[model samples]
Target chain A: MGFWKTWFSTPESVSATKSAAFEEHTASTGDPSANSDRIVFSTERDIDLYELEELCDAVGWSRRPLRKVKKAIEHSFLVASMWQVRGNQRRLIGFARATSDHAFNATIWDVVVHPDFQGKGLGKALMKYVLKKLRSEEISNVTLFADPHVVDFYRTMGFMSDPEGIKGMFWYPH
Target chain B: MGFWKTWFSTPESVSATKSAAFEEHTASTGDPSANSDRIVFSTERDIDLYELEELCDAVGWSRRPLRKVKKAIEHSFLVASMWQVRGNQRRLIGFARATSDHAFNATIWDVVVHPDFQGKGLGKALMKYVLKKLRSEEISNVTLFADPHVVDFYRTMGFMSDPEGIKGMFWYPH
Candidate 1:
């Protein structure tokens, strides 16, 4: 691995080891909370509209019509939520939603970690939960758009800038 | 409107005019062909995998594993295909796909026009069809990643950069 990185070479062929490594990594780390916070992650898509709105407002995302907001949450293929459960009450703290064809490609969107739980790895945990779900469904090619400040954080989790010529674009009618 | 652009706005309340203008725009030009090319756009989610594969390959996007490619196409919420029909045969010349929660957000992906059909405005027409679908569904936040070179093309269609502090990120495990 050391020699391969320093020297120039063609991008290597798909290695048999990568699939095994990914499976092992996911299997070992699958459902465990990384630290003592006990932040539970849920893949249920039944999040309440008011709760979602509060999360977005807390993060300063633009306020949108409630119906539109609800559509975005319910239609996602993988909707992961991070929670802090005390006895019977579950407080929503982090969220990450993905839209994918459940096969070739998926894009992660609107990832938020409640301000109160920002320092913990809840966001990462939410993403990992989604990734594991996608993996089980055999989907690949996950993508997302983050604010530049958090780009480095996503990079730490295996995302990279567009390869060569590809770029990201969007239009907001507001 | 001009003053609103210059100052630090708390992101004012959603305006009524924007929605009216959007409705007018779509109502006026919604289904018409842009020019003499006679391109027809369809919002049908069913697509021919071989044709899609050929389009992706033409654009030199890394060839996705075949099953993943098939799944990506099947799962899109809105798949806008541009066709040039000649006497009962429909040719798939341009393609774009999106996945949205049909409410607050949608992301466009794998936009490609066959190299033979590149100069025409089919790409824009396909996008317009998609925007209309999203608009009718009441989805508001729409995003896509493009190469920096064509950012202007997307801009002309009303997409701006990462609003001030935002950035786009992705991960390709291949």
Candidate 2:
């Protein structure tokens, strides 16, 4: 079987989870349709997705299956999501994730800003959301990485060079 | 189609492997015979097997035969293997893994201590090996999940409480 057909042809999707999470993050200063150089913040509760490949292709997000997408959603829930919007349109502009036990710890992952909207301070805005939740929840420390040049951005957010931090690696199946 | 047959019976078993590797480490100062306290740390390069299922069941590590292991191994440059030993002799005590980029970033995985040696700090000793190597190489960061009560152990090792740091979810295909 072909790669696409073999991996993504299944009709069974993790759709319609129907969570009441909207009650948690009801604060947003901007609107999805508001026209400006501004962005909107919202916490979607239930996301029904079927064609991850098609959706990711359309929006230029990485095309992965249910597993990766679910990880993205779960990570976003632990932190909060900030959308870079022009007017009513929204895209996954900048994001930071958290791994939390809700009592005394949380870790951050995949903090990214869309290349099209990088210098506009969207990253700062997204970090703002992550930091607010982490600090208020008594999650004293938040950690992450930077691509050498962007190290300054994290430093501005109160993260310093953790010369002794842990390590991350990737392996290919070839 | 039987489980064992499908598992252990491989036609190319004899000559397929490129080579076998056995590196050395200072076994934990704790009781070496305590089966549950022992953990094994190996790299993909160290593993000589091709079939993923065999690696999965090698030492009873809970993992799926996904591209993740392949990626980790590739990133690790074949320095990885599954550990399985009985006692005292410490014949590869248990199974540990890496998430490597083949060149730099790689996070170790599983790190199963044999059933009989649960709380003897063997697992921690194995992690010490991975951390030391990554740190010496000045790696990006390492990530993994410890069993809740063990979070403090990881924290002491400088892993931020970002369980959400590298969150993942799955829905297996039928």
| Best candidate (score: lDDT) | 1
lDDT of 1 by residue, B29-117 (tens): 45455222234555555566787778878888777777676666677777777665444466777788887776666788878888876
For the predicted complex of model 2, DockQ is 0.06
Superposed model 2: Cα runs more than 4 Å off = A1-37, A45-62, A75-79, A84-88, A163-174, B1-121, B124-174
Instruction: Give me candidate 1's TM-score against the actual structure.
Output: 0.71
TM-score of 2: 0.40
In model 1, the fraction of reference contacts reproduced equals 0.79
Model 1, residue A127: distance off in Å is: 2.9
Q: Give a tens-digit lDDT track for model 2, residues B86-129.
A: 34332434456543332223445555555444454555555655
Q: Note the Cα lDDT for every prediction shown.
A: 0.66, 0.44
Please state the error at residue B71 of candidate 2 in Å. Answer: 33
True contacts kept of each: 0.79, 0.01
